[model samples]
Target: MLQSSDYDPLTAAMRPPPGETQEQREEREAAEAEALEVSNRIDAEIKASKQAMKRQKKPIRVLVLGQSMSGKTTTIKNFQMIYAQKSWAEERSSWHIVICFNLVRNVNTIADTLNEETTDSILTGRRSSLTEWHRSVLFRLSPLRRIENDLKAFLGAGSSESVEIHHPNRPNTSDGLRDSPSAQQISPPEDAKRPQEFCIWSSSGWKSILNQVKTRSAQGKESQVPRMVRAVLNSCKDDIHLLWNDPVVQSLLRAKHGRLEETPGFFLNDVDRILSTDYTPGDEDIVRARLRTTGVQEYRFTLDKGTGTSRDWVMYDVATAWIPYFPDITALIFLAPVSSFNERLMENPRINRLEDTFVLWKTVCSSKILANVQLILFMNKTDILRRKLEHGYQVKDHIPEFGGNKNEFSSVLEWFRRVFRKLFTDNNSSLNRKFIAHFTNVIDTKATQHTLQAGKFSTSRSESMALRYGCFKVQAAILRNDIEEAGLM
Candidate 1:
C-alpha cells in the first residue's frame, strides 16, 4: 500500500501545464530532437578519440636495406650524425681496430710477395712455406699487433691469441677474405697487462705502429706505390706510402694485377690525417671508413616534433637474401649505388654490383608482404660516380647495356634513373604505385640531411593516408567490441 503512493509517474518535475498550445508541443518535440543529435555527436567524438589514441600509439619504423658496401650503412650513419651524435662517439673505437688491421695485412702481403719473387720457382707455384720472411715481416708488423689483440680480448675471443699466424693453419679462413684474421698463437709475452680499456688513441698501440714501420728502401718518390694495400694501409702510413712507391712493390702489384685504385674504401689515396696521434674520426672519415654492418642494428632517437612537442623514432639497419630480412620492417629505404654500375660484387666477382641491385629492387617492390608499405629508392654514391667519369672510367667497359651511350655523368645518370623508374612502373600495373627517388651522395651530410627531411615528410603523409583507409576498419572494430560487451550476437 505504501509502494503505490511512493512511485508517482506524474511527478512535479515531469509535469507539463494543462491545455498546452500546439506551438508549445511542436517546440518541445524539436528540443528533444536537438538533445538526441547532441548525444550522437558526443558518441562519435568518443569513438574518434579512441581511434586517434591507437594511431598515436603505433610508431613509424623505417628500414635501410641494401647489399654490402652499397652505402646503406653510410645512410644510417648520416641519420645518426644528424639526430644522435653521442651514440656515434661511443662506437668510434671499433674503427681504429679496422684501420690498424689494414696496415699490417698489406705489409705482410708485400713481404710474402717479395719472398715469392725471389724464389722464382713461380713455375711450380707450390705454396711457399716461406717461414723466414713470414716471421721477419710478422716481427716488423708487431707494433700494430696490440690493437688486434685488444680487439680480440674486447670481443671475448679469450686469450690463446697469436702473433705469428701460419696463414695455412687458420681455421675457417674464407678465400678472398681480406677482413678476418685467424688465431694461430705465436709467442705473446707472459704476464702482460690486460688490454688497457679499449681506447686506441690513449693506448701506445698506435704509437708503436708509427715507430716501427720505416722502409729501408726508397729508390724513388713516385706515386702508385701505396695502391695495393690502399684498403688496409692507414696505420704506419708514411713508411707504407714509401714502401708502396718502391719499384719492387710496384713490380709485385703489376705481377699480382691488383687494381686497388678504382675501388671505394681505398683510403690509401686520401684520408691520411686520421692516422695521426691525436686524430679523431671526422664525419667524412666515419662515412668513408670500411666497417661492413654484419647484422641487423636498431637505432632510436627523439625527433624534434615542434615547440613543446616531440616523439621518439626508430630505424633499423636491415639486410637482403645474402643478408637476412628485418621482421620489424615498417617502411623501406632502398639504396642503389650509382657508382656500382661499373663495379663487380666482392662476394661474386662474376656478377655486376648494379645487376644485383636491380634484382634486390624487384624483390622488394613486388613482395606481397610489403604490398601497401611505403617504398623510397635512394640512388646513392653519385659523388663517386662523378669522380669516376671525370677521371675517364667508362661505364660501357663494365656494363654491356646502353651500347655507345654518351659517357658524360649526367647523361649516364639519367639512363640509370630511367631503368629504375620503368622497372616498378611496367611490372606492377595493378599496384599503380608511383616510384619516388632521390639522388644522394650519402657520405655527404648536407645531401643526406635534406633527403631525411623529405623522407620524414613523405612518411607522415603515407601514415595519414593509411589512417584514412583504416578508419572504417577501426569503426567496425569498435562496433564489434560494443556488441560483445552487450552479449548481443
Candidate 2:
C-alpha cells in the first residue's frame, strides 16, 4: 500500500509559490470545480443509459378496430372512465348538449311517423292530438335548428359553421358543460379557414327562444302543447314507457315495419329527464349516448393494472378507413355487434349488417399487419341480443344458414363463434396465432372491467406453457368440433 505522504513531493510541486496572490488561489479553486463537474457528468451519463433501456421496453399499444358503430369508441370511453378519471368529468360536461339533441330528434321521429294520423283515439284525446303537439314542439324548436346542425358538425358530420346558442341553465353541479376540443365556434370569417368543424355560441335568436319560455312560465300562460306531449318529455321512465306501449303507436310501427321497438336509447324514453332545465347526463347516460364513430380517433389512459407494470395504456378507436399501419402492435381488439344480425348497414342499406361485420372481421384478420399479433374477438351487444330473443325474433329468418332447429341465444352465439373460427383456421399460415373470444356487453362497465382484468395480458405477454396450454385447448376444441360435425370423431 502507498504511504499517506508518498504524494507530498508531487503536491508541493503543484502548489503556488510562497507569496501566491489571491487570483492564483481563485484559479486553482475554479479548476477543481471544473474537474468535479466533469466527474458528475460522467455519473449522469451512466444513469441515463440505464433509463434508456427501460424506456425502450415501451408500454402496450393496443389497436381497437371495427366497422362503424361496433363499440370501438365506447370501449375507449370505458377505458377512460376506469383509468383517467381526473379528466372524464370535464369531458362529460360537453355531452349535455348532445343529450338534448338526442331527445328532440326522437320526438321528431315519432311525429314524422304519425303525421297522417287523424282519427286515432290514443292520439286525439280531448286534451290534444299528438300531431298538433308535434307541430307545436317543432314550431317552438325552430330556433334550435342552427344549434343542432352545429353540434352535428362538431361530432365529425362534415365541415360546417358551428352554431353556439345561449345556454339557459348553467347548473352548479359537476356534470359537464364543456365542449370537445376538436371544434369550436368562431365569428364569421373574412377569408376561408381550414374547414374542419363548427361551433355555436349564445346567439340572439337562441336567447330569445329561452326568454319566451321563461316569460310564459312566469305568467302561467296557457300552452297549446298537450299534457301527453309534456309527458313524453316530463316523466322520464313512466311516460316513455307509456308512449312506446301505446296501442296506436304499436299499430303504426307494425304497419310501417319500423324498427323503433327493437332498438335501445329511444331518447324518447329519457326525454323529460334529459330535457328538464336541470338536465345533465349521468355517467350511464354518457355511456349509453349513441354517437357514430366517424374517423380514426385515439384514447389514452394509464391503467392501474394491466399487461405489465408500465401502467401506460394506449388504445386507438379506428373506423373502417384510414387506419394507421402500426408495426409494433401488442394486441388487436376486433369487435362485431352480435345484435346487428337482423339490421342493415347504416351506410349501405342493401347489405345485411352482420354480413358486413363478417366481411370486416375477415379483412382485418387476414391483414399481414396483424399476422403475428394476438386476436381478441368481442361479440358485442349481448344485452340487445338477449332482448331480441325475448321479443321472439327468429334468427333463421334473418340468417338462414343458422338452421331452424335452434333459435335461442346459445345456438346463435355458437354459430357466430364457429364462423369466426373457420375464418381463422382457413387463413392461418401455420396456425400459430391464437384467437381468443368473449361475449361482451361492453356497455356494462363491470363486465368489461372483468374482461380487461382476465385478458389484460393475453395480448402483451410472451408465450408461456400455461398460455400455450390455453391456446392448445382452444385449438383442440375447434378441431374436435369440426370432427363431430363431420361425423368422424
Candidate 3:
C-alpha cells in the first residue's frame, strides 16, 4: 500500500497532472463516445419496439375466476400494475388484459333466501322445493318503487302535503273553494296548475274481480269467493304503487316482450351438487338449489384495476341478481388450509370422520366443473410447516413430492406437478391434460380483504407470480419434460 510519504499529503493529488496524461485522456474520451453511441442505439431500438407494440391493435382478454377468498382479486391487481399503461415511449402505452370476478354477493343472497323452508313455505307448499310462489314474488317485487314514488310526489298525484288525483282544473271549483278580498287572497292557486284529466285504466282481469266483489256486496250474497275477491281488490289498490315500481316488470312493459338474463357459471341437475353436506330434504339449501337449478339468466359482474394506479379499479357489479347466469369458466384456483391437507393424510382422530383431502380432491374432480377446468390449487400456510417441524411431526413420504422434511418448498412444488398430472394427463396420447391444480392459503390480512374495497386485497406482483406464474411455469415445464422424455415433443 502507498503510504503518505509516497505522495505529498498537502498537494491533494495522487496522480499526474492533466497535461501529463494527454494520450490517456484521449483514450478515455474515445471510450465515453463509444458508450454514448451504444446508449443512443439502444434507446432508438427500444423506441421502435414500443412503437410496434402500440401500432398493434388487438386487445388481450384474460378472465380470472375462483372460489370466494381464493386470491383472484390479488392476482388481477398484480397483473394490472405490471402491464396497465406501461410505457417505453411517450406515444406508446400498454393495456392490461385481465378481469376478475367474485360470485359471493349474488351467491350469498340466493343462498340466504333458499336456506330454510321460506321459498317452499311461500311458493310451493312442498316444504322443500321453490314453487311458483317464490318465483312470482321475486319477479313481482319492484326494484324501482322508491324512485317511482318520488316521481309521483313530483307529479302531485300522492304526497304527504297534498292529494290531487281528480281533475282540479275547473275554474268554478277553484272559485267555489277560494273566498276572500281580492287584495288579501291568493287566487286559490291556478286551476290550470291542477291535473287536467285522469283515468285509472284497470286491466280486464282486475276489473272483472272488482265487479264480482261489488256485485256480491250489492246483492248481500257475501261468501268465501266474494270475500277473497274483495281482499284481492283491496290488496291491488293498497299495493298499486309497488306494482309499478318493479324494474323487471317495468322493463317487460316497456319492451312489450323480452327475456331476462339469470344464469350462474355452473349448473347441476342434482341439488346435492350445490347443497352443503349437512343439507336435508326439508332444509333451505335444497330449496335454494332447486331455484338456482330452474331459474333463467342471472347477472354477474367482472372487476379489474384501472391502469397504473393501486387506488383505483373498475367495478362491473350488476345491480340485479338473477339465475342461470355466467358461462362455464376454464380454470379453477382451489384454496385450502395446509393443516387440513395434513389432517386428511394423517386421518386425524378428531376430524377423521370428515371428508379426507384426497377424497375431497376426487369429489371436486368429479364435479361438473372439472369437465372443462384446469385447477390451480393453493397449498397455503406453508409457513405452518416451520412450527410443525419443531414439534417432531413429519410430512408423510407417501406424498413426498408435496414437501417432506427435506427441501420442503421444492417438494411441495413437485407434489403439485405430479398430482395435477395424474388427474389430468392422458397416458396413451400426446395430448397433455388441459387441467391444472395448485394449493395455497390466505393467512394475511391482504388475503382476507373483500374484493370490492377500494384499496383492499392488494398484494405484491412478486408474491402473486410466485404462485401464479410459478405454478404455470413448473407445471408446463413438467409436461414438456415428460413429452420430450417420451420422444413426444
Candidate 4:
C-alpha cells in the first residue's frame, strides 16, 4: 500500500528505468555489476587490513644498561648482525671511517705517551729508553695526528666531547656498596687521571655520519677525507708497526698505562691488513671496533621466528639517564664487566670500575618501577678476566676481600658471580623473580650470537608466562565476584 515515491530513494534510483531500450538496459546492468565488484574489493581490503592489525603484536621492548665501555653497544651490534642481517650488511661499509679513526687514535695516544715520557726523563735528569731513532719514528708518524682530527671532524660533535662518568642516586647506607671499606680502598690517587679517549653520543647523528659515507660511495664521488685517511695510514703503516713492537713502548704501556693490546679497538696488531689500499671491514672487525656511546641508542628489528610467525622488537642502549623514561620495558640486560676489578672508569678514575658497577646494579635492583621487569645480568668480559689471570694479575692484590681464593678462571668467575647474585637477591624485593646471568665477551660474534639467541627465547617465554599469569589473576577476580553475587562465598 506504499507509494513508489515513498520507497527509499537509493533503492528507487537503482531500479531499471521505465520503458528502457534493450541496449540501454544491458549497458546499465554492466555498469551496476562493475560498481558492485569495486565495492566488494574495497570491503575485502578493509577486512584484510583489520586482520593484519590484529595479528601485529605490540613491539617487545628491551633496555640494555651498563657503565661506559661495558659492551652495551657491542651487544646491540650482535643483535643486529643476527636478526637484522640485511640492514647490518648495508651499514658494515660505513664503519670503515670509524675503524680508521680508532687506529689513528691509538697511534696518537702512543705518540703522546712517548713524548710525555721523554719530556719527564729530560726534566728529571733520568735516562730514557727512547733514543733519537725512536724520536724520528714519532716524527714520521705525525701525519696521523692531522688525519685523526679530520676523521673526528667528519664524525661530528659526538666524537669531540670528553667521556664522563654518570653517578646515579644510591640506596641508603644500610643497602649500598658506596660506604664499604673495599670501595674506599679502590679509589685512585688524587693526582691520577685517565687519558682522553674518543667518544660519541647517540644524538650525534651516527646514522647520518654513516650514510654520508654510503651516499658518497653510491654517487661515485668518495670524500677526500677517507682517501686522505687511507693515504696517511698506508704511508705510516710500517712506522706504526715499529712503534707498537718497540720494547720501550711495550714496557711503558705495561708499566704505566696498562696494556694497550688489552684495550678495546687495539688495531696495531692488524696494521698491515687494515692499512692496505683495498680494505673493507669484516664482521669481526666491525664487532671489535670501539666507538664509545655517550647517550641512549635505540634499535628496532622485525624478527622472524621461522615458524611462519614474526615479532617486532625495540632495544634501547642506555646510559645513566634511563630510569624515568623506560620503567615499562619488558626486560633489562645489565652488563657488569667482571674484569674491571683492577681498573677505574675512564671518566672518574677515583671510583673503582667494579664498585661503580655494583652500586649501579644495587640501585637498579632496588627500583620500584623495575620490580616486575625481567632482569638478565651479563657478567661480561670474562675472556679478558681469563687472560688477566693467565698473565698472573692477582685478584687479591686489587680486591682485598678476594682473599685466599685461587686466582684461576673458574674460581674468579664464580666469586664474581656470587657477588652479583647476592646483590640481586639482597636488593630485589620480588621473590618470584629468578636470577639469570651469562658470561659474555661481546666482541666474539659467534659466541655472543648464540647467547643472544638464547636470551631472546628466554625473554619471549617470560613475557608469555607473565601474560598468562595476568589472565589467571583477572579470571580469578571474575570468579570471586560471581560467587559473591550468587551467595556461594
Global Cα RMSD, each model: 17.9, 14.9, 30.0, 9.4
Residue 147's lDDT within candidate 2 is 44
- Error (Å) of candidate 3 at residue 468 is 5.6
Of the candidates shown, which would achieve the greatest lDDT relative to the real structure?
4
Q: In model 1, how many backbone clashes occur? A: 4
**C-alpha lDDT of all candidate models, in order:** 0.50, 0.52, 0.31, 0.69
Model 3: how far residue 284 lies from native, Å: 33
**Could you tell which candidate, 3 or 4, scores higher by TM-score?**
4
TM-score of every candidate? 0.56, 0.63, 0.26, 0.80
Candidate 2 weakest lDDT stretch, 10 residues: 174-183
lDDT of 2 by residue, 1-489 (tens): 668767587777877779878998998889989999999999999999998887664655667777555666566666566455655665565565555555544544454455545445455564423555445544554434444454454333333341111111211111111111111122323432221223222222122223443454568772433223333344434434555566766676555434553333446556556757666677667766654333345555554432234356566665545444677767667777888766643333334557666766776677776776666667777667777778787766666556665778777877877876677666654356766566666355442334333432332223211211121112212222222232322
Candidate order (lDDT): 4, 2, 1, 3
What global local distance difference test value does model 3 have?
A: 0.31
How large an RMSD does model 4 have?
A: 9.4
Candidate 1: tens digits of C-alpha lDDT, residues 1-489? 558869777685556668989999888879879999999999999999999887663444667677666666566555555445455565554455445444344454555566556586556766544445444544555554454444333323232211211111112212221111211112223532121212222122222222222211133432232222233344456565655666656655544533443333345544366455566656665655543323356666554422122444466666555223545445567878777665544333444567667766777777766665556677776777888688787777666665699999889888888777766665543364446565655344443343343322222333211111111112112222222232322
